[model samples]
Target: MPMRRLRPRPALPSRRKAAATVVAAALVGGAFVGILSLTGTPHAPSARAAEGTGAGEHVRAKALPADAHGKSGKPGRPVRGVRPPVSVVQIVAHPDDDLFFMNPDVSQSLHSGNPLTGVYLTAGESDGVNARPRDAKAAAPDKAGYAEARQNGIRAAYAEMATGSRTSPWDRSAIPTKGGGWAELDTLRARPQIRLVWLQLREAGSVNGDRPYSLHGLWNGRIGVLASQRAAGTPVPTDFAYTKEQVVATLTGILERFRPTFVRMQDPSPGTYPKTGRFRDHQDHLYGARFVQSALARYAELPGHPHVGVQNYLGYPTSVLPHTLDPETADAKLRTVKTYAWLDGVHDCGTDAGCGDLKVAARPGGRGWTQTVRYARGTSTSWVQRDRDGGLHAFSVLDGRLAAWRKPADAVAWRGPELLPGGGLDSGVTSVTLPDGRIAVFGTRTTLGDSATDYRREVVTTVQDEPGGGFGPWLSLGTPEPDDASGTSDISAPAVTVAPDGLATVVLRDSRHRLTAREQRTDGDWDPWRPLGGTDVYGDPVAATDAEGRGYVFASTPKTVLAWAAQSPGEPLAGPAATGLPPTTLALSASAAPDGEGVRLWFRKPASGDLRSADFSGTGPVSPVTELPGTGVAGYGPVSGGDGLVAVRSRTGFLATAPHGRSGSRPVWTLEKFLFSGAPDAGTDGVAAIGLDARLHWTPAGR
Candidate 1:
């Protein structure tokens, strides 16, 4: 009777236009937002905060404002960011864009519990089929045994999301993809920090009007006729022909073997827009987002590449839109991938892949499934630190602009490329920080029109540190202006914290999707945006603050997965509940509790790909949630060293975690190895510090 308590929300709304159209229709319905939580709520228990009323002040006096400058009401100010160790890797392209576009940043870097690995890149064999559901001898079988039954249905869904028991059995191995051709690779192993590698290939073709092998004849600049296999021999075994630079050198040799920081693909933009019908997305998601942007520009000219982060998802018809799930932390990510039973066959769920070929087989008349959905990368990022000298930073934004990412070794006398001054980054730059030390960076910068709700505005770029330290060039808080027209405004991708008096609270998702909270008046300015309101969830809103500074924001909508409070100094927050997530979600990050608890949210469940957690307990709600193993394609893990740790650069090498207590959620250390071949510089002491692989390892925070 779960499915969110047999579907309760009898019309909830209210948390500011349901947080901008249900977290922008569950991020453009990717992973079909897990079939929009297949109707899940029966666990109850949540909903509390009401006595002398002060769970934090019932939505900050009505969503905050009065000049709202730095406290996120914004007038000016800015500043600085990790968790990482070794033994972890994740390289994605299909089989659940790493469970919803590299989810919860690959389930908060596998709960920092370490030892993880994943690399799929196609055997996502499309319709020729496999995640089961095809009867008549499996519909039309023999496409190389339905590509080995969709590689044993993603090895029983990554052995039931990394070892919960999917019967554990894969070890295949055929490898070699960049032109020499071969493809087969599969490995599952339940523990020792998990593992899954697939490699299949083939999918591509389809520009919208699918018919005669399309992706517009293999990425409009036609190269190997879109994943050649022409003669459609069925399920790529290759007659030994390749060349799209040998399939981008068999995906740049799986990115020089596990050199991933975050890379999730699909939606390469020309999904066919000419008349607009099929161009909304798909063509093996635009040749897998242009072959992972030409294998990350050849993994940044090889020689040790790994500080990479990319996510894109959204195909089919973006599922009519609106379902969102940050309902105060979507029931702690629905208790980390639970529900699936739904009364009968759920495909029997024994081997763990527990059936979810986009869902439907729950039995009793069935028909509820909606294309086994999985879309990701609608932009949701995290990274922090503003002062203290160690410098190291990044606040992220893509497709909407507002960037920042510093490190050239951060200190110990480092040297080069962290500079990126103003010039309006223009695309979706979700969030960035420096709240009090002074270099802020929030995102979303497109205005002119054409969907994304015609682009409203919520930018906020700042950088003014010099006097003896470093950064000084950028500035633009400019009066909450961002209205580009306001179709309810649509905002997420902004989360900054900084209190203890220095001011700065910033958390986002406005246009009334609520979760607002803008306060920065110690003289810095920003004051009018208020409303830590509640109800509605799905995220791209992450915030952190502890060591006494107070604040916390988290979010993730659709009806649960929450966190929002302030607790003191003029208070006004503390009312929002439920956090039992996991029915398929990806994107939500938080960390600021260095040793114990105050804030710690991170997600990713794409049905059972795993990686989940919860902690923030100022009164009740968020706790007891856990699940960790591996899966990441983008959410660009690693970058946050304000105290409690977080760092992830997967493909199976370099992981970090800290999470802490309430007795559930795990990961206090998991490192895999030389995590990032290039990008990584965490060290708020928990140390992640990477850049050019050379094989390093330190991984330990676990206990």
Candidate 2:
């Protein structure tokens, strides 16, 4: 599509002067209390009153009632008997964070005919210039005006995505937050189910610089309160501030009111560069997500809340990785960015702030951001396991608990995504079958203490007391890293293997990109964690057993794959052998070889989603690699299943499956329409995935 051009509207002298005064006062004392119209025209009270409920009700920040800070109610207490409907709430740091990191999924949710709410924590008023650096007519630093323009652009983009029209009208108003501040709420007139909320808090301004006024500083207690930067035309009549506790309370209150069934946020632990020790993502994206994490923890304790599933999206780091979307999906995503960037230069939104974010118009794709979307966690392929009796069991972390689903050996239907008792479980849960037929589930858990310094992520597990029975209490397997400050809690999800003698080993990649392991002794006690010796290891590790009863663990670096193996059934693992494998996309999965002699490793070619595999005997040179025949479909993430069937993500961000190992007959991939979380799991009986709607979806064998 070609960019459109339109005539610019003349600036109104009175409104322009008022905006300049507001900016000057803000710079003088680091506080802003003035209000100015961004559109050069005052909002009519009649128009606001006709929009929606509470549209014209404006409240001053100084007059909030004392009861506004009331508790979110008792923990684990249900006030309603019926479960709430499926609703999604995405909390992000800035306007485009969701568009850049969570799209395709965001668009799919909008199209699902369910309610979706987007909450932006920051004003995104970077440098306050609404034009490219080269633009001669770039506006001066007016933070409030710039923020308002970005909000306008986001509204246009969301309206077009939901109602197929960029000019869709919205009912804009102010809502008093549970945090003692007012947030701007906008609801699309055409689709009342879609909403956008702006917290209007000050942005960090720099990508990684240490700014004490930003969320990072507030989180670390370097600042007492983070002040708001109300947009020029926001319905919120006055500015306010939020303490760390107040921010969490606000989010918890939102959760209680909206009661969303799924939540999306940026990655709190995006890790750091191994060489420079710089953050891999914007500091706001990281620390802002930490606040969301805290809120979710508090909300989980409140009464009458629906079960929620969460997915974290990768931000700036995705630019360096392989693109995950196919051309068609990428193009669709780019169109939305163009709308938000105001690339067409059409001033149709009736705003003197220019309708969209002009600064983004210079480079709408955001340094390759528009072309890819990747999950920061929950991509493990070991989530499914077959029991000794031919039953299949799948596990996923939902609502801070273990959600288990099972299909009996003789039954045609899958039943019970029954959540096990306990909380604090993070995304991604892997399972392994014990020698006695019992199953053990492994995952990482986050603990949000009263202080920021107490935030931590640790490995935890629960196993069935007996085969096909209930699970025991969650057992903690302390993290190898000292704390969140030094490591940013960048540990990978646990990958486990159980030996023939009933000894189990759990392997994980730590913050320093090295492998660490904790083994289970024959007495049922765990050993202290120790380094396994691998460098630059990225992504989660995978473990599997061979026909000879030896266990192997594998992880990937940017260059090649690394392997460690146990010599015997219950021996210590040794060697970080260079497998001589070509560079992969850092996604790996393993299953028993059809010949019953060794284990087969599956991975994707870098930048090319074609499947590749090789057989490994755990302690020797690897076998020659073989490429699976292509079916014109390509996507990232670990591919599951062996010779009988395979499940993978298709180019369209949907689940797909095909028959494997059929000679002379090309595999035909059948695609599912829904988007799903984590990776797909396949067995001889069927394939399964956790849908984005937080439910289990199954495709039986031979369908």
Candidate 3:
């Protein structure tokens, strides 16, 4: 027996008249055009949804709020530099998940002035109840309306971040998603640089070992036994008919269009819940993550698809774990901890859409909101490369400059010979091969006076060429002269990237810390530094050039790996384009390698304790690429350079590689450890390993 279908909603008086007029005209024009649209075009609805497009008949009409737009219709700011070579696309199960977990990267990309997009899989509708602050006039604010509340909350949050105003109005329009569901999307909030893609699927209840039935169990095929019952009086409908493939297709369609360079999703593992032996994370979060993994597999098979970087964020159960933040910016974010935790007035109202959903007001004295720290604060790390032969050099403040290693098979493995420069190695040291083949290193330095507070700011550069690759001397590059000193004060280490033009551009994240660029002439002449007007990125920034000779910058804060590029030559780089990053304590290191006709970014994710790669091939953003695990802390070369095959040291002393421009699961080469520079010898064969003696083992490609 065929299942009975629901009746279609009656058209409004005016719409009915309009349809009649259209039908009359169509009849006069004949059936050819009608047949084409009905059978071949995307305009045709599926047989089951022929009448109402799957959302069902009598669709509830919620007057969408005003469309949010900046004066121009574009979202966000225009990227100043040549368009970025790497694209990034971030995907998450719910709205605000990126901000809460993959942020700094998301925010960083917007500032990178690059093309980026965010895709939310679910409407993130929680309990549907919008809670109000206790101090409000109305004690019991409302009983139900969680979905609307979440919508309001997310829109407010997005509007605030995009347009620089939380009060920005949103114009909502229903866009049909795969499986016939409708997504009410928000239009431009900031500038048009950023776009919000929402697939308004229902949210699953958190399985805190409490809920008997949930969306998680239903999606996994447990059906009635593990599913939540529907509310009797609610008009909002629920369906458990979607298959795993249908859900993946919904996401796949979004990816096909965006082609992001990065995709951030919640941790699928959800780790183990401390209190309950079961997975601590909500079942939805886990399943959603697995669904994403499936989509990635499909995406990887697509021709000309962008290289995507995937970042897994810690979830609710892992919230209590130690985490890290951009040292300099941690305080500013910490200020909002109270607001995120408590039911403050800030999250109370939804000026445009009503209160947003997702999270509910915390119970009295409950575990309030808190920032997750990945690593200990103020732990400084750097990637030092030998200019002599482009070998890898890594330095950390782990035990102060006392830890220095050199590459040599004879040296003892894993043992450090602290090479404390007479004046202490400056913070943020990066290596660059000079036109003359000499290795140049740059970092920030401060001159101490008699008093602890007495100090002067300065930028310093050094040169090294030899077996030990010891620095020759420090040449002062003058002060960046920043405007703010909230707590810490020091000019950032200059970010150096040898452009395709052979001219070296030294960029710095300044004290008030704007990004400034200076060029080192191939003739050895230095240009006066100029401000690039992007947000201050808080870590060691790396730069690379695309096939078109466009300059790009890749940097890391405690939260993300960000890329910047100019729209064209002589223009400032775009605001930061995000590397879909999770909150990690990774001392990030990045290098660009040839990708077919362009360049791709090979990065190390310290948080995951492995090396990974991604490329930007589209106009939107990069996609997430699965990391090839094996290399450990020793296998890492935190700072890596070279093309074709690249080299990086893992903390565990193993070297690994993902062939240039290739995707899918492939085996990686793990090089044997030989003590060289307290680490492994960096290589160009795309393989290198680190040892205790600092001596690096290098293997030429194919040799």
From the highest TM-score down, the ranking of the candidates is 2, 3, 1
- lDDT for each residue of candidate 1 in 392-415, tens digit (9 for 90 to 100): 444443212233333323432111
Which tens-of-lDDT digit does each residue in 1-703 have in candidate 3?
Answer: 1222111222111100001010111111101011000011111211221111000110111111010111111112221111113344666766556555554434445554445667766655554444444434443333234445555555555555555665677665655556444444456644555666666555664654444234454444454332112222222355333454566676776777766544556654433322344665566675576567556656655655533434445455434432433223333333322233233555445343344432334432123112332211111222434434333343332111222333332321212223445343332345555434455556555443333234344666666554345566567677556321221242455666554344667787654435777776657677777776545344445564433334567565645555566443334455455555443333443333332322343444432434454443323223343434433332222434334444443322233332333443233443332221222223342233321111112343453
Q: List the residue pairs that clash in candidate 2.
A: none
Strongest candidate by TM-score: 2
Best by lDDT: 2
Tens-digit lDDT string for candidate 2 (1-703): 1212111122111100000111011111111211110011111112111011010101111111111111211112112112124688999999988888899788878886789999999999888888876873555788888898999999999999998999999999999999999899999999999999999999999887979999999999999999999888899989999998888888887787777767999999888876777787899999999999888888877765656779888899877765656567778899999999889888898877768888788888887888777788887877777777777887887678887766666754455556688888889988877767788889999887777799889999998899889899999999998878776888998888667787888999998899999999879899999999999887888876544445668788878777787655578777676666667778788764433333456677655556665643323222344444444666667788554667787665567777665233356676765556789887666677776556555666674
RMSD of 1: 23.7
In candidate 1, position 196 carries an lDDT of 60
- Indicate whether candidate 1 or candidate 2 has the larger lDDT: 2
Each candidate: RMSD to true structure?
Answer: 23.7, 18.0, 28.0
Ranking of models by lDDT: 2, 3, 1
lDDT of 3 at 310: 46
**Which candidate, 1 or 3, would have the higher lDDT against the true structure?**
3
Worst lDDT window (10 residues) for model 3?
14-23
For model 1, where is the 10-residue window of minimal lDDT?
12-21
